[model samples]
Target: MHKRFLIIVIGLFLLFPLLGRAVDSNQQILQLRAQIEELQKKANEYRKIVATS
Candidate 1:
């Protein structure tokens, strides 16, 4: 019973950081910026290919 309680406590501690990050606005903004930049790069490449073809 003691081991099981310790395991549950450890699991909750490990999960807290992930829960915190899920609600973090700064991280969300950075992720959005990265995705937008990647998509823009892909669009530019596609435009160049279409122009040449």
Candidate 2:
């Protein structure tokens, strides 16, 4: 039982960083998507101006 517990602890310790990195990567993806949307809006506005001129 002690050995099983130790193995579980070691496995969790190794997995913790991967889980944290997954969360961090998700946040980065969200930020990048927001930036892309903002840039797309600016591009549409520019297109409208060009069309008007």
Candidate 3:
């Protein structure tokens, strides 16, 4: 019974944070921006190739 209680308490401690919104890391934000830029460049290049052919 004591072990079960301890397990329940620990579960709540971890779950509490997930109940609130979280922050994104700077590295993650920068990576997303780079991905968007690369996709846009590829799209423009594809459009040019289609126009030529």
Please tell me which predicted candidate would have the highest lDDT against the true structure: 2
Could you give me the TM-score of model 3 versus the true structure? 0.51
- Model 2 residue pairs with clashes: none
User: Candidate 3: what lDDT?
Assistant: 0.87
**lDDT tens digits, residue span 1-53, model 3:** 99999999999999877655344455678899999999999999999999999
lDDT of 2 by residue, 1-53 (tens): 99999999999999999999999999999999999999999999999999999
Which residue window of length 10 is worst by lDDT in model 2?
Answer: 1-10
TM-score winner, 1 or 2: 2
User: Listing every candidate in turn, what is its Cα RMSD in Å to the true structure after a full C-alpha superposition?
Assistant: 6.0, 0.7, 6.2
**Candidate models: Cα lDDT each:** 0.96, 1.00, 0.87
TM-score of each candidate?
Answer: 0.57, 0.91, 0.51
- 1-53: candidate 1 lDDT, tens digit per residue: 99999999999999999889877977899999999999999999999999999
| Clash total of candidate 2 | 0
TM-score ranking from best candidate downward: 2, 1, 3
Clashing pairs in 1: none
Error of model 1, residue 27, in angstroms: 0.4
Candidate 1: residue 31 Cα off by (Å): 0.2
